[model samples]
Target: MLSSSGRGPSLVRSAILLAIAALVATFFTAPAAQAADGQISGLAGKCVDVAGASNANGTPVQLYDCNGSGAQRWSNPGDGTLRALGKCLDVSGNSTADGALVHLWDCTGAANQRWLVSGANDIVNPQANKCLDVQNRSSANGARLQIWTCTGQSNQKWNAPASGGGGNPQPGGFVVSEAQFNQMFPGRNSFYSYSGLTAALSAYPAFANTGSDTVKRQEAAAFLANVSHETGGLVHVVEQNTANYPHYCDTSQSYGCPAGQAAYYGRGPIQLSWNFNYKAAGDALGINLLNNPWLVQNDAAVAWKTGLWYWNTQNGPGTMTPHNAMVNQAGFGQTIRSINGSLECDGRNPAQVQSRINNYQRFTQILGTTPGGNLYC
Candidate 1:
């Protein structure tokens, strides 16, 4: 058996091989599946607020053409619940009472709020044991939906429209609608507000660049798909001590303490921390690092620039193509390893350093490259 030190690299290699095999299998099967099953478009422009007063439950639910407003924005957690404006389509706090008011509330991870998207376009609240129903059976504009016992009614039916076009509604159910979905989470544009999925990719212009509309859309889709998984759907950040505090201050001088300076902790996209990183990022983005190390987390654009700088300059994407990483896995691994080591120059075992290898693996998977090979280190 390999020692623990040796095992880390070996296991990483194995993971890469497994990932490559999976990629090959997916490539062979995805096209056919895409053709046969049809595309799973977004639900942006087509999503409508159920008509009626936007208060709580018993509101008449009606479909209106989307206006790209927050009210029309919906979040499908893929856990069955569809959220709008930060509130969930809840079954009245999971009261389980029949004819319970379906009010929107903060997500509490309750069963009543837990939903399932059925094959028939029905948004089923299993805890309430009902389908989302339109109030008083009204089909007029400005109707809202209420939770009623599932009777398979037509009002409960929804149609998820295709992206950038008129979508045919599926028979017997509601579709989340693609146009409305994209509008709500409008690609890199959404990144401007938060450090989530849209923001992370947007932070890296080279990654987000699309030579043309077609290429842009494809690249955006792929980037979103992969980053969503890696970052846990933009809900999670890589920053350390995030759960406990809003910011972490560096107190140790051992890592790479400049002679008289204090504190050097990780922050922002991929948690770019330390005095050295701040300097490097500053150089890349033409910002003054020593003066504004906090900019990584304080400014979205700067955070993104820092991440791109790391990807391009420190991570070898600048000197080598992604394809080269595949061909020369050892060289790729070594470059990442070097970054990992150097990242600790300020302090050993920085949280970012601990997660570096995992992050790299995620990067390779997103790039659709094999993870294994030799170490250029």
Candidate 2:
């Protein structure tokens, strides 16, 4: 990744994006409950619904008029997460903050994704340590559902089917949804497609729901912070310095740049540049990026995957990959050292390193985590 004086804004925006995107839910095993069917009615007797009756991940779970529709039917499976339409009732982004939206998602065993019926009027989400709330206590139709401090208000009350609660709570693995992804980037939803990215993470057992909150947040924060500096919060799919584009091809290699000299320019979330990097990324991702470098800008998931591959593998200027720096308690500064330490670390370029640190600090806070010390290389 290359950074110039102009890269300052990239770090800032990347921090904002990471802070929000890291809110995606983390999964853990929970006890399962027997499935029971009924309507879960809340404020004004409105029914909890799978918006548009769509059984898709990140489908908005809202309060709608009760019309004896299938969308209103729910099952309280003992696994802690409420079930309807074969999907789990989830807290958007695993957010504990007041007013975080609720949605129906593929059930993951993560704590935030789990819900328990108190058998009273309250529907409790153990992960958030809050109660399901009707936005602003509005009793009107289409009021959005959110997580708020537990209150004994009628809006917080719920009526579900009676059950001693038997079906095993299937493990809800870590997977990013369209809704959660959008919340992470806020304004950059259209910048990259997330389906492939989400699927890739889900399919990778080693990287999916495999750590504690601190470890998870730190890893994600560290990775995105670096990439944000590289691509400017994914604002640019390719490098802006067009003059430097053609120079990325190293002719000395046994095999010359197959995509042509100018083709191997900086691109994607990590701004992958050089023919060697394109070839390596393409080989790992099972794509022909070396011969077709433009895929980085054309495919959002592919772009994200390439970035992740670098974070997880490359040692660069540091002794360990950025992923290891965070998970091993090596501190965020090490990650900076790993990415572009030669250019910015050891007081070489304090401005650039500080910019990356600023983003890292903000992201950790937004993730409800503390930024460990030694933030500067």
Candidate 3:
């Protein structure tokens, strides 16, 4: 076998696989899957556009009435990005703060250039955890676009390229770095990939980003701790209890389980079960999971998303969302009460509850933060 250094010419020839745009190879490790070009219409049927139809960098992106012009044309390259005029739609200054200006800039694969067009039609700068908005909600022509806190408001809604609207989203600004994640779950299953978790972070932008830095670290630790417990240190991909599989489908709902009785069994990091949960998570994330419940287990990003959906939205067997519990300083115990408290909270399952607490403590230590108060539910 030849040494790595001896294969230089062949490696050089292989690297010249294709001649794409100048920054295309630098931005993505591989070539883009597909580029769908179209008009990105926003409020009042106005198009998200480059002001003055200029291809120059730093042109302000704005909202203008649909005019079938190249200035209004955008491209979704199916790599969780939006571009126009050969430049990226960028958040100015690469700031993660809200109300940042959106403009055209050279595509350097920076976090500011990454965007996710959610299923609900919101164009989100995942790094900033904000939506592309018409400044001050104005619908008049030439209203400049900026990144604002997502409120699901009309000004934030958009009709982007169909191929780029759903499925994968750009992942950015995750509080837990890959190094920290690996330290926390050294034995984690390959399926629980770090990229998958970050990719899923776009599904709910405010998850670990809701509060101060300390709070952010705490929230990330709390979530991973719980996930570690759910999957046995992140080793198990699906619920090991095979007997529980067939019992997940409920026939009372208007739409019965189409994937068979056992299809919605406990899967993903949270071990999401029941047909209702699949439907709810799928609906919220803009992916059809009711009939294709297996996506949670099949796709790593989808699996992490199911866990995030439950963490950021659902109250489970307790009051208030887990995110609210942590952000509002309700303590870690409240999080336990919020997720699976019916069986584990109170005096019922102290050992299991303690196990979660133990994991939380370890993760907090790994993240260099305190575990905070409320150790027990």
Give me the candidate number with maximum lDDT. 3
Comparison by lDDT, 1 against 3, better one: 3
How many pairs collide in each candidate, listed in order?
40, 13, 0
> Of models 1 and 2, which has the larger lDDT?
2
lDDT of 2 by residue, 1-377 (tens): 42321122222111101111122223222222322247777777678877899998889988888777788887655555577788888888878676889998877777667664442345656444456889988888778899765444588777775442554332343333455445555555365666656544421222323346566666666666677666666567777878777777878767788878888777777777777777766765567888898888887777877776666556665676566566557788987876777667888899989878887776666666778877888
Q: Which regions of candidate 1 deviate over 4 angstroms?
A: 1-233, 236-238, 242-263, 316-377
State the number of backbone clashes in model 1.
Answer: 40
lDDT of 3 by residue, 26-134 (tens): 1111112222347887789788889998978889999887887888777777655677888889889876555789899988877678765554556766454467888
Candidate 3 regions off by >4 Å? 1-63, 66-172
What are the candidates' C-alpha RMSDs? 20.8, 15.6, 16.3
lDDT of each: 0.39, 0.64, 0.71
TM-score of each: 0.30, 0.54, 0.61
Model 1 score (lDDT): 0.39
